[model samples]
Target chain A: MPSDALPDDPLPSWHDGRTKRAILDFIARVTKQGGPDYAPPAERIAVFDNDGTLWAEKPVYFQAQFALDEIARKAKENPALARQEPYRSVLAKDLKALTADNHKGLLQTLAVTHANMTTEEFASRVQDWLKTARHPVTKRPYTEMVYQPQLELLALLGKTGFRTFIVSGGGVEFMRVFADKVYGVPPERVVGSSDVVTFRMGKDGKPELYKTAKVEFVDDGPGKPVGINRFIGRRPILAFGNSDGDLQMLQYVTGGAGPRLGLLVHHTDGAREWAYDRKSPVGKLDKALDEAGARGWTVVDMKQDWKEVFPPAP
Target chain B: MPSDALPDDPLPSWHDGRTKRAILDFIARVTKQGGPDYAPPAERIAVFDNDGTLWAEKPVYFQAQFALDEIARKAKENPALARQEPYRSVLAKDLKALTADNHKGLLQTLAVTHANMTTEEFASRVQDWLKTARHPVTKRPYTEMVYQPQLELLALLGKTGFRTFIVSGGGVEFMRVFADKVYGVPPERVVGSSDVVTFRMGKDGKPELYKTAKVEFVDDGPGKPVGINRFIGRRPILAFGNSDGDLQMLQYVTGGAGPRLGLLVHHTDGAREWAYDRKSPVGKLDKALDEAGARGWTVVDMKQDWKEVFPPAP
Candidate 1:
């Protein structure tokens, strides 16, 4: 029995819309061999921005929530933490206080909660958190909150021989914990903002890698392209992103000399997901939204473009 | 009609020796399904050092030659460069001057030649140089001088579903230009020392990644394990290297709690390839050589194991 539908349709979770049409068309044109726009499998590199694009980043980033919880937990044991600058702001649940002055307070908060441990220890902590961490509002495990459309897109691209990577402003260790299980992106393909790690032999004559408080590289806005170039060593043929943080990455990917895709996930669904942008600090989408039309980038409106927000809980 | 020899033998360029036997044995044990030694395809990460391990580094690193040529080219237009600190030493052909105080002089030289360009500009520069640069001794193109035995081994590992990556102390962009063609390792899989890069839109309002003069990550010796951790994010099951620069990487790979293979390529063929170890500043294989036996690592004597050195000149 012949089916009417095409097997090549990769993003089943996405509604039939202009954005979905553009995505499928682009994939088809580039992957057609012996055709004008054919790019071999080696050149089919796709990079994705995490946070808002892959999973939800509504009230705050998932990593930020982890840090907030850590501060709250630590302050319960140490009363003096309530008196500290960053810890005090965090304990007061002051989101605005943390975002003031270009996120300096937020950086300080991250330093307190994330650093000062060995790389292995930090990884273990993140893994443990992922096994149980729940979203603030949704009450679902953070991993379960990943966009169904995006996951379908990732699986589709992988099936078509595209190598997908997660390039985000989140902590590398934090993201690596769930990247493979949720996104099918391995630890190596996941590049993110990171702490300075030093290599040394422990007192027991075994090697050790320690994560220092100092930030080594921040994979955000301008840092996105830098991270892609330094780590991947290739210009991405496709990039999917959201917010002002992904502006440079969109331009970097679409501006390259080939058939490319630059997608901006616009959060317009107020019921299924939060829809604040420009005014909100978390995943702000001002300049990128304004420039999307001019750049010829496809904007996926969460309300109109995605049929579902999160997948059914397993 | 068929040959009696096993078609599974992938190292035809390599003569039968303890090193070859151990390599085959390790691959067999790890890849046998449902066995105690079985490692999934994703876990079979193999890292190989460039320079002495992949190609001849006797005269100097291919990159060092590029810098020398760049210095000479610039000095031709401006004679004053001949009197500059590093330039004067380079002009004097002094190896001791370059390696003195842990290669401070060499770092300065690299800073002058390799930095302050856009990432695209640097890649273009490397690609252009690769097209014309010839080896100082063989007078062959540098790409033509890669070891055939190592190349065959890389292909074999790829066939067995082992992901091969070139992790070298050489410049990331510089090695990436030729890694695909020479070693069959794709650009994304090549990890190396790098200069800092920043992303910004150019005057044309298009994104551009600029390579700064500042040294960011150094992937050598102690830096090797850090590089592996940052880039690959998995302890390699197989590691092949030649110099002491790969010492920490060897320990990092073999020290992991699993079946692993660490092989050192000893340059014993002085006639076919220049042989210098303890006293040679370039690719010094000292402490690693001393510890190879204690760690039960395979040491391939080039004179005995390699039936042929460089591939036939094109």
Candidate 2:
């Protein structure tokens, strides 16, 4: 039967053929009346892993970079901080020395730099920094370097009665400040990690929560699925991710009854964007690669799939 | 000059007195052109305490009552819970026995009944219970018992371009599930206490978070102010509360520069509602009495000020 609905917009040179077709086909089937995978608008849920899935996450996760910078900035002003091991390493910009201590150093950096400010104040600082911060590799504003393919996917899904969500490992509060503007996903729809924030009366006589160093929740890998169920309360029929950190999420999404889709973005376009997998220090895509074929998951080869990696740098 | 925009519904009995007038007047001035307190619609923020301020917290908080009942129910089915101190007392329905253990019993009960469920499962359970549960005292659905005065006040504020937010010590997740339907406040605008939830792939092959027993954050008293600043960023020009739990919130709101209003709902209507102060175990209004007077906060005397209490029970 000829359909009355307009055809979805074609992905230009930006989106890889395989990835773009898989996404558009999924959306088309989900929205088409009487189609095998068709779902009503209420049930048309799509979730994407952030970090490497939506944007670049190397040489380090953006948030970790923020913490490293903050630790260095704070340590320069306080001699006590410079005396500390991880802080001292961060202050020296010795990335090699900092990683030698393993994840413990990362945790320490997060604890020291991300805590004790009013939530409003922290949000404001993040907003100010994001406004001017450029990606070290791309040299484009970090936000502008967001993947063009992913951006198109989000908008395309939205047009197909899909309610998209960013199921991320990044701080929920941090992403919340700009997600709506950047992704068109409202704050309430973005689920991620969070720290404890206690409400207090400020000098200005307004109620606010000061962000604490205390870890409230960590949303990553298995934690991603947990956060989705907790905050969203519905199983997404479609899920997209990059790296092993998203394996559990894909497993959960594709395991559902009836029609489901899971896609893994494989980094293989070093010419257009930095590419690495398996042994890479950040966004390692290993176990997921081994299981993709067996699990019937579509794997997107970045070099073949995405013609344009990122939007033109301003 | 007479206002042309006044509501024609004939103000509810709840808003026929001085307390209501103060709120309406503040709303009117803040929204009217050339008015001293006038603010643009985007900046018209108003925050309210949830428990006693929006709904009844009398006898005990609704969530506390739910926690206690859940413990008792579980204890009846499990031998292990019967061995625990607080659960042992709670299972016996011995309010006297439970009170003897104080906050310890309450915390233990909460830890058991509120944790371990998938976030989706928990939200569904809450939604189901809300549909059927009735207030112990009022014998009406808990949702129906929400303060009519506050409802009118919310509407009045909305008419004046203010965005109302619920800042409470209750679970933000719990309130979020129903706030939009009941109070016209969206989920994102509701801030409250929470526990850590970890995402995982469930047996059903979907991402879900298991609620943890550990406290993530406590949104009470001082926490209210902190939550406001963290979640809203902007300072509210008006605030309202019912007990000492809200003292910090009121302080924060009133402390802001320019025109601000703070009000406390004093339980003085023994005929229409329960009346108790300072010495009361629940919703204690002690420290806030002197603070309110000192800071020029409007204290609402329920019996004398409110001509009505609840809406016709649903």
Best by lDDT: 1
**Chain A TM-score from candidate 2:** 0.90
How many clashes show up per model? Answer: 0, 18
Consecutive 10-residue window with the lowest summed lDDT within model 2 chain B: B1-10
Task: Write the residue-wise lDDT of candidate 1 on A1-314 in tens digits.
Answer: 01133364567788897889999888888888877888899999999999999999867788878888778877888988899879899888787998899998898888878888778888887777777778879899889989999999998888777999999999888898789989999989999998888888777687878788998889998899889998899998999998999998998999988798899998988999988778878999999999899989999999999988899989
Worst 10 residues of 1 chain B by lDDT: B1-10
What TM-score does chain A of each model score against the native chain A? 0.92, 0.90
- Give the alpha-carbon lDDT of every model: 0.87, 0.77
lDDT of 1 by residue, B37-117 (tens): 999988999999998999988687888888888777667779998898688888888879988999988877887778877
Q: Please state the Cα-based DockQ of model 2 relative to the true two-chain complex.
A: 0.31
Tens digit of lDDT per residue, candidate 2, span A1-314?
A: 12354343546645546666677677777887898877877677889888888888877888776776667667777879797877877777776776675666666677776777876677776787688777887777667767887887787678767789888888988887778777787665788888877765567655556788888677888887766665554678988899898888888788777778998889887887778999997889999889798888999888888877887665
